[model samples]
Target: MSPRKILGWLRAYAAHDDPLVATANLVALVVASNVPFYPVYHLLLIGRDAWPALLEAPVALIFFAIPWVSRRSGLVGRTLPPLVGVANTLFCMKILGEASGNALFLVPCVVAAAFSFRAKERWVMLPLVWLPVAVFLLSIDRMGAPLAPFTDAQFAAMLRLNAVSTGIFVGFLGMLYGRAGIESARASR
Candidate 1:
């Protein structure tokens, strides 16, 4: 297919109001966000420990593959959302373990789940995305010091900042989706 056609296909795929599409879009967003960070982490004098940031690309690729494989194997409708939710939670834990202060990554998955899954499914996913992180944060002392290079104050600040930013992002996405739903409903009527 031509590049334009391929791009159009991807756009349509992502625009679908389905759980699988949300999962794919979330993975794609992570990959897109990570790719540009590589150069900045390497060239800029930000910090030496930013190397782990590069792992997000491959991780997202792996997560992206899950939905594709499950779809091919006829498991998309029954299983994809929960699987993506678990994977997202694991990734959040990995970030926490790495002391990356990027736990905010969970927010997008939760937000996407809101758009994609039924209310019951979202209830399941919401805890999966948050509970582990809450436990990890609470047991930080038991887990020993963070491996990230940041000092205690810096780490705390980063976590707080991530939380605030994630809240804003979730609010924005909620408004945007709510508006779209209203518009579509009106159009249908």
Candidate 2:
């Protein structure tokens, strides 16, 4: 399908779906986009212990499922993405170690959650936000030895890659939410 057609389809899809579904789709796309890069990430490690990176494929599929599942449950749609993100990042960080920088993704999880819900849903939003922070806090002192034997230079590269990627995701989120805020204000006028 053409890029225009695909985007038009997404625009139409966003129009009909509950607002939560849009966030779910965004989360899905982010995860799915990284799937192809997993091999490259493994290559950076000189091809050692590629299995942890392999786990992201199923996680992406799981993320993609959120929008479909949201048709039936808003709670699931809003809750699953960050929860799964926290779980996946924690799992990857544990095996890849802190130096691999998988832990940085938890920030995006918090940002995604913050944008996914409204103030009216503060009770629900509270847990979604806290889960990532909680996971980070609990794991801070517990991260184990690197399972892949990535050299110090490899670790530094991984940290830089993840940090830059996280910044980009957050910037993307700002653009999305910022435009959304403008649209909402215009609608209310």
Candidate 3:
């Protein structure tokens, strides 16, 4: 799209209006999912390998917290998408190496894609949710890898979990965004 359109979207996102807040929340969810890694760091009590996930949680939490703080402070709700965009890339990389991490990490991306649609047509973003999920599945199959480690049962469970998580998140975003859109429109009048 044109820069003007992109800027318009960015302006809307930063405005503390409905969709923007919801978008921020989605970004928070993405970071929140990573929160588990912190406990795992202590649980495993490992050294360097665990550090990335360990450090990522708090940073993600801060990103998640910003929108709420900004709302109270009357600051614009900007910063979430860019943060989420970066986080998504990181999560995608993690997924490449870690099979179990895929389901949780996909949450934010799915939510963000949902919010990107006009509230009335948010369902159109459902397919975007499937994209990461499909890649994750294909990854488990080791389609490009030297070998696949998961059994059929494990793969089935992963698919089931992916489907359920995607459904729940997509539904959640749709309802949240849909309500926010209606409320915003009403407030404007």
Candidate 4:
């Protein structure tokens, strides 16, 4: 498709009354946006492991393709982002370890789940919301130990990087969900 056509479709796809679908689409777009910067991040950060950091590019592509996938499967579209998010975070934690502060990303993953599901889906969303917490709690000791151990300087820098990045990601999610709330309120009128 032409660039204009693709953009139009993405905009239309993102417009949905279901909070899960809408939020997932936005999250996918935002996550996919980071694929291009993976190389830069690998060079400047993650000095030892170029491949693990770049592995995220494929995940980002998966997020980017979610809209297309969801067109055929609404359930998958609505649920895939958080499921994949938790899994991805876990993978990063295993490789990057607790020192990178990667676990902080789990907070937004749960928060988004809470907001994404409506009354009917609350039960279904509950397990997802806690999955990250459960896994992290069980593996807390391991997550803190860097796989290969970063130097003191690297540890401090990774912590700062993850902290700032998580903050920005959390804020992005808040804005998307917050906008949805406003729309919902206006619709009730």
Q: How does model 3 score by TM-score?
A: 0.46
Q: Report every candidate's CA lDDT.
A: 0.49, 0.73, 0.50, 0.73
Per-residue alpha-carbon lDDT of model 3 for 118-152, expressed as tens digits?
54544545565555566556555452321224444
Better of 1 and 4 by lDDT: 4
Q: Going through the candidates in order, what is the number of backbone clashes in each?
A: 0, 0, 0, 1
Worst 10 residues of 1 by lDDT: 73-82
Angstrom error at residue 44, model 3: 16
For 1-189, candidate 4 gives per-residue lDDT tens digits of 899998888788665665557777878777777755743674487575534565556778777877777777656686777777888788777766776677777887887777766677778688878887897798787655544666667666767777888898888888888887777667768
By lDDT, is 1 or 2 better?
2
C-alpha TM-scores of all predictions: 0.55, 0.83, 0.46, 0.83
Model 1, 19-46: lDDT tens per residue?
Answer: 3444445444444444455424432433
| Candidate 1: segments with Cα more than 4 A from true spot | 1-6, 15-45, 66-100, 119-143, 152-168, 179-189
